[model samples]
Target chain A: MTPLLECRSVTKRFGGLAAVDDVSCVVEEGSVTAVIGPNGAGKTTFFNCVSSIYPATSGEVRFEGVDVTRLAPHVVTRLGIARTFQNIRLFRGMSALENVITARHCRTKAGVVASLLRLPSQRREEAESEAIARELLAFVGVAKWADSAAGSLPYGDQRRLEIARALATEPSLLLLDEPAAGMNPRESQDLVELIRRISKRGLTVLLIEHHMKVVMGISTHIVVLDHGVKIADGTPEAVRNDSKVIEAYLGKEDVT
Target chain B: MRDRIVRLLVATLAAFLLALPVASLRGNSSTGFTIVWTPAFVTAAMVLVGGAILFAAVEAQRRGTAFWDARAATDSAVGRRRPCAAQAWTLGVLVATVAALPLLGLPGAWTKLLLETMVFATIAVGLQITIGMAGLLVLGHAAFWAVGAYTFGLLTVHQGWNFWIAFPAAGVAAALTGLVIGLPALRLRGDYLAVVTLGFGEAVRWVIKNEQDVTGGDANLPGNIVPGSFRKPMGALGEWLWQPAAVDGRTFEPGTVQALIDRECYWFALVLLVVCVACVHLLAKSRVGRALFALREDETAAKCMGIDTTRVKLVAFMASALWAGLAGVVPAVHRGSINPEMFDFNTSVLFVAMVVLGGLGSITGSIVGAALLWMLPALLANWFPEVQEYRYLFFGALMAAMMVVRPEGLFGGARRKGAA
Candidate 1:
């Protein structure tokens, strides 16, 4: 079967620096794929290009064989790609539930006039959105904090809230940038289970992970990058033992 | 229960103490305090009472006192029945009280001032949609007001159009101007947006000032903007609607007719204000409204949620302009005059102050803010004429005091915590 999301030799540049340089990857349907590299490896920048937060400088991105390189970030979201930032960006003033509900914007359509009139359809959609938002929060284990401001949430809860918000978009593919960044070991362990559970739900998850244990344990496929170049791609075990992957992580040192 | 009584006594005593000096200062006789109903004294008393009640309520909750248990029990009971049933009931009572004000037999001037307050309330509420909810700081809001007022004034005077015909045209003209201004300004955020809007306001003022042939420039526009269609009081319906009800015995004097018109205009403005409030309340709770909040919070995140940030911002600008535009009809129809000086930068700043004072993102806050600001000035003029000369100085001090006391505004939304 065709991969759910494919990046075709994508390149992103800023001035003289190439943030993402001639990188390519394929995320299989219903698989947890990990992109791992050192700092400035362009993992987050690659995610940005795929999510259309920044348009790719060259080449294309395809979702189920459709070119989406030129689409706006919102349009990309509508086309079933939703992502969280490397740093959490929840609506600070809004409640966690509202943060999730806001992500359901494309899925729900109640314009100003219908809302003003309080049309039956609009009310129904609102109720449904609220219910879904609550459910998503619960799935992320932050349901009890639903009414609390997202900004005021504990760091772990805020990260999970961002995930819940992304999930509210009901995407076919979810991009999580550093899903385990700054997380404690226990939290990272819980996140591994969450990613596994998400994959079991038949949604493709492409995550950037720093924790080697997380990338090795849960991700079915691992893509390794170094200096904005994709150096290794295969099953987790295959990518781990590759000489280049080891070389990228450590120094070359004329490895045999 | 014991704590509640003590709290109530404390509040009452504080109110009395606060009101005493104010009442005594305004007393006609300096030697001995005599009960007098000067505007400033009455205002002082009201403010003190309100402050006392708020303080008591807050303190009671902090102390875990039984002072609120009774009210909370009743509130929960009401809340269980329907989500906003208590609010609906409170609103009904408030409307009934306002409607009964004329029955208390206030002087015509006071009634006229109250009508003017309603007009400003409408404008402040309109401005709230942009600055309060959408998080767009607008210094050019008065330009939209000018568009509405001048459009109505010009149509009724020069074009000989009726108020009924000109009213909607004024709103449309202002909305269009909002759209035009928003298209460019929305591209810039925060301070840059403010600068663009400030320029836009000045541009509108300059156009009216220089285009003397049409606008009448420094001189005011001609009179008779309110339609005469109801002047004869329709046959039966008109007479029933506006009977020119006997006020102080004799009717038909110029002052009497103006007073009667003031009463009629008060009702008109009240109805419009109610409609505007309802519309604002509805819009603020809608999906579009949430989108605006999302846009305000984080534009990039909002866009990632599939919200067209630019579109939402533009709609907020137009919606805000529409409210202010519609409100402009009152001043035009009431005064039958239009001039560039009326829609100055100070007027824009005052409306902004009103929105901030009322509580940003709170509809009721905007109304209360507008009413307090407008009413306080009038009352000061009545009881302390000399202070009126230093009106801006007094307003600046009041604004500073309000900021220190309640930066979120008197009715700021729970979500607007930590908001500047």
Candidate 2:
């Protein structure tokens, strides 16, 4: 079967530096794939390329067998690839539910005239969007914050709210960048369970995380990178034992 | 009880201090400003200070605490789903008051001021869509207003079109102009976009000013004779429905007929204000409104959430321009002539100030802001002619004070909160 996402030698260059250099990977359907690396390992850059935030300099990114390399970020989202930011980027002034409802913008079809007139079709769509947003908020365990401003929510809840917002797009593949960065052990554990629940629902997830426990605990596949280059790709156990992965994480073993 | 008395005393003193500028007069060269101390000034000061103290005491008694403590107010009303009945009642009362003003035998000058205020209110509400909702600081809004006015002026004077046809044509013309400007300017953000729009506004005025024969340039449009075609006469249907006893038997007195016509015009403007307010209120609660709010908060997140930012911004621009265009018709018809100077950068800035003073995203705030800013100077001029030169200085001070005291504005309801 074809993979859900395929990146062929994607290279993103900024001036003279290659943030993501000639890296290729495939994300299979119905699997939680984790991209792990130390600080400045280009994990977030790789995700940006796939989401079309930057668009790879010399590569093709295929989503569900369609080339979406040059598509706008919003178009990429509409094509069933949604992503969260490394630093939580919620609509700070808007209510939590409004943030999710905004994410359902592409899914709803009401234009200015319909909205202005408050046509029956538009009203129905609005109601449906709200219902979906509320349900997603509950699923991500931030239901109580649905009415609060997204900015005022606690850090972990903010992370979960971002996930709920991404899921609102009804994406086939959800990309989370550093979701557990500021989360505590208990929060990361809860996040692990959340990812499992998401995967169980048949949606593929592509995540960039530094927390080894959460990464090893939930991801079915692992891709390791260091210095903008992919060094290992396999199951969690295989990647855990790879010498290159170990050397990248810990400085090279010195022999005197 | 002691604290309440102390608070009232402090508030009264503060009110007295704040009223000093308005109660005093400036002297030439040698002597600085001096307190007027006239019977009228003293009486006014007494009334103001007394009113402030009375209000504080009453409010404190009712709320059972310091009236200044806003946190004591319940949050149940903040994000409630129901439409606020108090707001509706306030709006109804205000509209009825304005509608009755002309019929109650208001002087011609006051009627004209009221009519002008309503026109500015409509324009301010329209600008709210671009500046408040979409968070695009459009400094050239008057250009769209000018476009609308010129469209109406040209169509009626040159093309000889009926008022009904020209009105909508004016709106469409302005909307088209908005689209043209929005296409290139929407690519810029914040201050750069503001400067570009400002330039566009000036460019439009220059074009109208230089076009001489076409627009009458600086002299005003329909230069020779103010066309009677622009005046929307109460049709046969209107005359048949209600013929006043004063005009029923005798030949029409020009003054009586003019007053009746002005009343009709006032009602027409009031109706337009209602429609503009309702449309904006509805739009604010819609999907496009949510997208605008999201865009204002964060563009990248909004884009990632699948919003077409450019399209949304353009929609706001066109919508706002459409209203300004529609509002442009009123001035053209009311004045019976259009001048490029009427829609200059100063007018644009005035509209911007109205939006900002009223509260960025508040619909009612825009109307209130427009009414206060437009009418206050005129009212002051009528009551205290001696302070004429200080009018804009007072306005500048009032706006600066408002910014410091309540940047969110008098009726800003943009910030949402959970039950606290």
Candidate 3:
């Protein structure tokens, strides 16, 4: 079968600097793929290109065999790819439940007239969206903060809320950027368990993380990048033991 | 305890001093400055000072907390609860009272004022969609209002279309204008969008002012476009139910007919206000509203949630402009005239001020804001002509004070903690 997501020599440039340069990778269906890199490794930039937040300056991105390189960010999302930011970007003023319910935008269809009229169909869709949002919030373990403002939630809860919001879009491919960045070990462990649970539900996850425990703990496959170039791709155990991956993380061995 | 007493006394004294209108700056060079305390000023000062002292004493005895602190607490509490039956009842009672006003022998001038207030209220509520909900700062909203009025004026007066036909057409015209402007303007965000909208507003007004023959330019619309007494149509409708033969022979006096027409117009405006408010309230609670709120909060996040930000923003713009257009028809039909000057930048600012003062995104707040900002000035002018000279100054001071005291607005719910 074709890979769930394939990037064929994708590149993104800002001015003269190539942030993500000619990097190609594949995310297999139902695999928990972790993209690991040191700081300035262009992991986030690659994610942006794939999600169409910043369209790649060169090459292509295909989801399930269809090219989506030129699609708008929203269209990319609608086509079953949802992502969380490196920094939490919830609808700050909205309630947690509202944040998740808002992600139901693509799944539901109700226009101005139907809304204004309070038609039965609109009401049914609204009820369904709310129910699904609540369920997602519970699944992420932040159900208690459903009515609290998303911005006011505790840090760990906010991360979980963002994950819930992404999941509310009902995406087949989930992109989690630095999900464990600010998390404590206990929280990151819980996130690993959550990822396992998510993958068990048959959804593929493509995460960019620096936390070795998280990347090695839950990811089935790992892709390593350093200075915008991919150096290793394989099962997590193989990538972890690779000499180049070791060199990229701990600097090159001196040839004295 | 002594310090508190001293503070209270000093506050009362300051209130008295501020209320005293003793100083004046004359425009003429010969008589530059003068201090004259008229008896009216003295009485006004005394009454104001007494009221302030009484209020302070009562407040000190009752809650002991600052007024605004208590108010904020209650506002948050109310905001948390979902809209319940009690709110619907309150709305019902308020509507009933307003509907009963003209029939209970409300004066003609007051009826007209209430009618005008309803028009502004509708516009302010509509504006909430863009500025309050979608977070689009459209400074040129009055351009849509102008489009609605002109469309109705041109169609009814020039083309001889029926009032009913022209009215809906006016709304459609404004919505089309909204779509045209939104297509380009929505691409720009925040302050840039605001400037573009402001320019669009001025451009529309200038077009109306310059297109002399078509719009009558600086002059008002051609022909007496105002409907001659809403009475005839109302009376004909009443006749269908219960018309007394004895009353028919009398051919009701012109004054009585005019009063009836005024009452009918007032009811019509009231109904429109109710419909607009209900529609907006419903829209705010719906899925589209969620998308709008999401868009307002964060465009990138909203897009990641699969929301088409551009399309949602356009929906908000068109919805708001549609209401403004519908509201634009009321004055043209009831007052019987349309002028480009009527829909100028000042009117747009006033509508925006009403929305802000009432609290962004608050439906009832919009109506209250419109009534306070629109009616208060007119009422003050009638009751205290001397204060009329300082109307704009008073308005500016009130707005500044409101910002300092309650930046979220009187009815605005407390925003999330740390939100900019």
Question: Of 2 and 3, which scores higher on DockQ?
Answer: 3
Better of 1 and 2 by DockQ: 1
lDDT by residue (tens digit), candidate 3, B331-387: 775665677898888888898899888776777568767877887787667657899
Model 2: CA > 4 A from native? B1-90, B225-232, B236-257, B414-420
Query: Which regions of candidate 1 deviate over 4 angstroms?
Result: A254-256, B1-83, B223-254, B413-420
Listed in order, each prediction's TM-score against the native is 0.85, 0.86, 0.86
In model 3, the runs with Cα more than 4 Å from the true position are B1-82, B223-233, B236-257, B416-420
For residues A3-78, write the lDDT of model 3, one tens digit per residue. 9999999999999998888999999999999999889999999999989997999999999898999999999999
State each model's CA lDDT, in order: 0.76, 0.78, 0.79
Ranking by lDDT: 3, 2, 1
**Candidate 2 clashes between residue pairs 3 or more apart in a chain or in different chains:** none
Per-residue lDDT of candidate 1, residues B260-329 (tens digit): 5666677768878888888877776777877887877788889888887888898999999997888888
RMSD of each: 6.2, 7.2, 8.1
Residue B271 local lDDT, model 1: 79
Interface DockQ of candidate 1: 0.53
Give the DockQ of candidate 3.
0.51
Q: In angstroms, give how far residue A149 of model 2 lies from its true place.
A: 1.7
Clashing pairs in 3: B226-B336
Question: Pairing residues by index, what is the TM-score of model 2?
Answer: 0.86
Model 1 chain B worst lDDT window (10 residues): B72-81
Clash totals for all models, in order? 1, 0, 1
What does TM-score give for chain A of every model?
0.98, 0.99, 0.99
